[model samples]
Target: MDNIRHRHITSFQSGYDPVLEPIVFDEKRKTKKPFRISSIKLKNTLAPALATIRNFYNKYYNIIHPLSFTFLSFLTRFYLISLSDVVMWDESHFGKFASHYLNRVFYFDVHPPLGKMMVALAGLLAGYDGSFNFESGTRYPEDLNYTFMRMFMASFGVLMVPLAYFTSIELGFSKHAVILVTLMVLFDTAYLCISRFILLDAMLLFFTFMTIFCMTKFHNQKCDPFSANWWRWLIMTGISIGCVSSVKWIGLFTTALVGLYTIEDLWNKLGDLSIPKIDYLKHWVARIICLIVLPILIYIGCFAIHFAILTHSGPGDSQMSSLFQAGLIGNDFAENPLELAYGSRITLKNTGFGGGLLHSHVEEYPGGSGQQQVTCYHHEDINNDWIVLKPREIEIYDNETDVDVEFVNNGDTIRLLHLGTERNLHSHEVPAPLTRAHWEVSCYGNDTNGDEKDYWVIEAVDDIYKKTNRIRSLSTSIRFRHKVLGCYLRAANIGLPDWGFRQVEVTCDKRNNPKDIFTHWNIERHWNSRLPPGGKANYKSKFLRDFWNLNVAMYNANNALVADPDGFDILTSKPRQWPILEVGLRMCNWASDLIKFYLLGNPAVWWSGTVSLIMFILTLFCYLVRRQRQYNDFSPVQWTYFLYVGRICLIGWLLHYLPFYIMGRVTYLHHYFPALYFSILMAGFLMDHFTASCSLKTKNIIFSIHYALIITIFWYFKDTAYGVYSPNIELRGKKWLNTWDIVD
Candidate 1:
């Protein structure tokens, strides 16, 4: 059968010719038989029949050419369906920027504008209102509008399916290999979820794939490496790489890998056994020009375009200068002495005090009889060995009463519950019975009681009306105690019974009152809380410190009682053009900007990481064990797999783990997607090897099982096992074991 197939294929070497032969097949044997024909009959009947059959087969299957496989793979994978019910968290932020861009607002996003720009284009086409604000807007009733944005992102994500397909095809992947890779990407929940959002990961992956595709094309072509036309492809490669970088800096790794691959290709082409000194010098210069100079020029050219558009200035205008200027003039008040003296700086110390300058000295009078003048301080004592600066609080209680309260430490779960009851309660219809209450609470560290805790208190109060007596009380209060310090109160009150009324006026004692100390109360709804006052409610007659100053009259024995509990008082602090809170917010926005690389997900744990690590080690062992295998005898796909896997290990170690350990930054995940891509590629090569050198069906079953497992693992854990949102939630409860819980 094999011999007959070979002969049949060989007969068409000069192009398909059906004349002068009659093709025959043995029905019983299920194989092609020897062909025999008269010349006249072959020309008239056999020739046309064979040609018609060939044309029909090619047209029906659409497999007449190799590129048809890529087209078909793309078509099948481009279903562009929405993934989950809720938009993933990060998509909301990008959707806002895209909406702003469509409204012609200047949006200085931490990420490049391309992804959001694309989303905005989709929104515009879908007739979305330009005034819509994602942060404040309701998602319902406008579900289709939001879906439009997601659909746009998902479509771009599906593009990766074809991108990988064509990329594999260009690299000489088998038809099965191409289909498998495309399906792998399609079925990956992580990939699909990310694609269905207005995030830059899909865009970054798309451009990186394009860069790889262009490089593969260049490598396959025979040309003068130094020729202008030949170098055009190299320039295109560099530009594509730059586009990836523009989306996310992590794309630089892909660029570097491609650059190294190009240099290796050039070195192979040289084939120099031993060259004279002068010829070696000449070759060296040309290599440097092709590898270094040209790539740099192309990279800079691409960056120049981005710079001009983003900065409103030309290149060489000082990249560091703009960042510094933005830090100084754009947002940081500490940089300006005048602003520091009179401006407001929000600190962890002054959470409750108004967040504006001139808060501390606003109430100063000639004598001590005036409203106690609020004072500000630059530094405060860090209590309990924790780095948080202690804030001051003042309380005037008519009397103390037993109360039950709930506390939360790291925003994970409950820690402790204190139980109590009220006296002289009559009816059995009381809102809360005079029994010990069981409350769920969470605690962080200790204060003076050796159980330093942060929590919200819950209580039920009874009321009497003229016509009828009813039992009702406000549910919770924010509470804390440390050393000689104690603070507890309803953070914000909802409507509750007070004697004969449905509302009550809650006020705090007057402290060192400063001039320009503006007070206003804000009632906000908790989106995720489960109790009453958990949803929408209102606050009445609650004093709000609009601003607080920490520098006016540093916390001392005399003014300590008047200080705000949360430390730095933004209300008493003088107003500044730029404040510290804004700076921190900007930094957060900047750091969070790294989600574009898709690699910014969580580090693989004991299972996924360990399995990949073992596979990598085994691949290394095999390569070392089979060192006798010549380069040519090994398929380029196999060789590439080895190179790719080694690259993955090297890059993953440097990019994902090292920064986290050394710099205290976990930005490495931004570039980790390449590791996954290369791992799958290695698996493909391994399957190919087993099929070619061993049993085909056995290898197929094994690979199919392995692929199924990979998919299952990713699917099961994709929600909580990876990405910025995942590990954070899982580790939220394990705060004792994680020092990195400060992210919230």
Candidate 2:
């Protein structure tokens, strides 16, 4: 009765007529008691509980979500890791490299040494003895402990999710967006399958993730520049950059992304008038020391360790400089004579980076001039040896050295007697097997008998030591010019037909380019019994020179991996085909009885990410057009955040991806994995941005649907990556796209 009277008095005071207010209040109180009491009780009961739950989610989602995803990633990544127990895809290549490391035998590969060293370390820790060759499709030996090696590698893949999660948080992603990013990486089928193998791609992907994470962390530290956390993250970013680049040259694309970010950062800082000039100078110095100097040291340090471990000479000895080879434990380069003379038996190595030794075998070319095949070989053999002698027309050849001991001089006409074939190195007007513009070089006539066509004038270009105009072992850069045809002997890295054993074609190039290193030759193995042996000092290799030479060789070798025109590679793919998930690589033998794995990305994740990227471009265009008309849709901070996420994800994807289309090297679907990561991040960004205006309930509903969709798609395709247990016939409808070869 008192409450009703108070409510009536308050209602009358709030501009209702006193009499009407009392009547209305009495009627409402009598008629609405059950409804009003229940409503009040329900509100009182639910509001506090909802607030508590929301507060807990907001406070702990970062911690709980990352931990949850990490646990889930471990399950996804480590499952069935040892299912096949057979060498698959690039495992055959990288595993052999790991063996080379454990055996301490020098081997040359196109990639940098750090990733292989880590693989070797894993093998060493696993008790592997470096005995198995890891041939493709070969079952692992019972004692090899390959499962342990793979588990070690898979650990890197497992951490990628948490790294991406933290990186998104540092980039200021909303809570829901963070979840999306983590899920996309955690459930990607290709990443899951590739990570479970003993391969370098996992390590490469790991360091790439680390670098981006460090970059974002470092970027956030800019507000308090030069703080301890700032310096720590800055140094970490540098270390990550060095490590990623050490895995593979493809890692350089990630480094380039960091570089672009830094450039933009410094440029923005330059425009700030409030920053003191000295402070700005310090900024420059800090970045230079951390980003440039530190990474180079790390890179050089990897090589230094690589050089220390691989002290024994192996098949890769011939790929290095003669001086570098001489330092190897089992190499005979230290025993060779120092000088070149008329009767010296020598191997002529092309001075071009990654070039091979001039060699001739008894086999003749099936087409072109029918003579003993002369080619360039990477390995050392007796067939690579040639005797330097006076031209046949100039003097009668003898089996023994002349008593006068004539030294080979520059511009002297000479005949190269192939020691293994007993034939003279000769070139004629006939076209080469592959390089038709140049004359074919072959071994013609017996050592005791040769014609004027065999005559080659030795042209001294420059010496490596800058000490001599005369020919010398491992130092002089000389060229051989066919005296009769005036063509320069060269190895342009062109391959010959099957009949010529597919060795590098040796041609007498009609075009004489003085700077062409292919035309330059050095005597790598000199053998003159009369001459004294060169001491170790003459064969000393400088680190800088060796480093430069090895990098150039790696570049040349990597560039040579283009698809052979006459061959077809079913496993190969195109850049355009990758983003759409148009194809996948068959990772192992597909026999019905064999447990095979197909490397394909989850279709939902890939297709959605690609669509998001396209939408981002259109959305940005619309926003800019609206802004131009002064229709301010976003606040200044919101606009900056939008551009920041766009630049990082969009620019990163372009950097890692567009280069593949421009690259001449043969590409596979796995090559797009790194770029796909950025696309996933971009998708998360767009999803969060577009839903920002929605009510909290609506947003949760959408996120739940998306999460369920990704999980369902991942489950459906899990067998493809996990391993095809049943026959291929059971997977008929699994192929969502016509281009997917999953069924077969």
Candidate 3:
């Protein structure tokens, strides 16, 4: 078309409907000298060939789609997968998570529980009995049925092709576009490699694509808004939301996409003259129930299942309250519950958003107000215990204060007496163990009782509205606000060296962010309880309270997780570089005998996707301009093409890709998979649009070139993508980029 050299290209190429373009290949173009196929025999032959393609579409389309889908699924299971045997990359993390599910060992992960749960389900179904530890670079156990697990994940990966294909058809894309979408996923080397690994990416992507697929199907039923199939697809979209969201919080990106579309759909419906007000109301309520309420219930159900299965305490226990821990079987808190009163000696434990306990060691600071180092200890020790001491004046007047068995009530201003060093928990002008902006809480001067700086007012958040409420057993979350310095006590979650026992650093900060768990402390072990003899733990009330505490902990932990200067991430990629396929992330390898799995995008898909994106923008701009100049002047296929390819897919891609740039977290190339999916679909749009006007011979040539290139590239990269190779082979003969290292 470009070589034909028209005098001027219109807002859109005229007379090119993707649906009929292949059928009417004999139609003459308005080029400088119209492109001609003067051969009578060739023209005669083309009719039968085109007629055969039309007949296949009209008669055997249904059979072909399913058959093609089956073949792709089988190919995915047979090849791209089942190539690796030993543990690779996140398999170590997720495989252990699966084992924990089998053993009922509760653990923590940044992602939601469903993906890991699915992984566990896959392993269980495959006859794995939670035996393998799945340590990094370690070989999987002999009896482990890894193939079934891999095949299970491969099934989800292959399911994406059909979803995209069917969704494309529903969106009114050309037959070629639908087929191209399937082929795009089939030949994507990175998709093949990542899906094969025992990770959540495969499931995450599957649910995400299904969510989009259902969304397209739902919207495609706009004319039949009251139809059974419409409602079915709508509800299925909501369920898909729950499925995808429960895999990773990043699924929020797709959720947001759906939300915006829902709003737009409703707004458009409301403006429709045919839609009565009552009908619009009915639609609104339906979407609210399906999209909002149903997804919420499903999301909560997944979490409830997560909590139910993980009954025993494991590595994640420290991140939860001791009261919450009491609910778990075979944990210390359940077996040994402690209560407390005034003058009761207790040790405060921080749930590890940032880890450690309220601790003080004998080691002094390097310089300035040198004393026993006050910190948060990660481990248990006798030195961590502190006495609930009254004010300096009350210590001498025992009769006045009754500093004996009287419970330390909420809002009570008390000084902590470090049992090991006998120094008041002081917060003065001295620099803290870490985060120098905060004041130090050091056991200064080695005094039995200290000055005003040492006195801390126990302001129990939400629990301290009254003075009568006492610090009871396994309850009462309070914050120590320094009276003199006027700053809240915090577990900085930063570790200090020898001076602070290399535990989490503790300090008093001027900032009192209510969302932060670092400033909140639960009286883990109070010596006096109101509960009668043989009283059991009230887990229902404790869980409700711990749920709020968990959110706070999650907030702090997620905050701490991002932008950690001490924790350098070599694999992390900037958000901007993702679309261009600039780099690769090395998954794992052992020095002795390496078989590295790098997280890299297929350059062919990534680069072509980028071009398609640019084309989408250019076409959109032209479409908008044309609409403005002559309203209702849209081409036949133009608006329909833009509906799925330009607007929805682009928005989905942007939603997944753009927000990561604002995040301070260490992100990698693998994070781009969701956006990469949209990009592949966008490429489909370009293929359909550009080829719509091409001659039969040119179309054949283009398709053949792409097919050959994809095959050649996939074949060339076979070893790196699938084979677990040794040092002897030359797998880097065509290292496309210097960064693309086939390390095995």
Q: Superposing all C-alpha atoms, what RMSD in Å does each candidate have to the true structure? A: 21.8, 9.4, 11.9
The lDDT, on a scale of 0 to 1, for candidate 1 is 0.39
Please tell me which model should have the higher TM-score, number 2 or number 3: 2
lDDT of each: 0.39, 0.88, 0.74
Q: What are the TM-scores, per candidate, against the unseen true structure?
A: 0.45, 0.89, 0.84
Give the alpha carbon lDDT tens digit for every residue of 102-213 in model 1: 5453333334444556667787877776565554222423444666665666565667766667666666665555655555655554455455555677787777667776
Question: Model 2 lDDT vs. the true structure?
Answer: 0.88
The weakest ten consecutive residues by lDDT in model 3 span: 17-26
Best by TM-score, which number?
Answer: 2
Candidate 1 matches the true fold with a TM-score of 0.45
lDDT tens digits by residue: candidate 2, 619-713: 99999999999999999988988898899999999999999988888999988989999999999999899898999999999988988999998
* lDDT value, candidate 3, whole model: 0.74
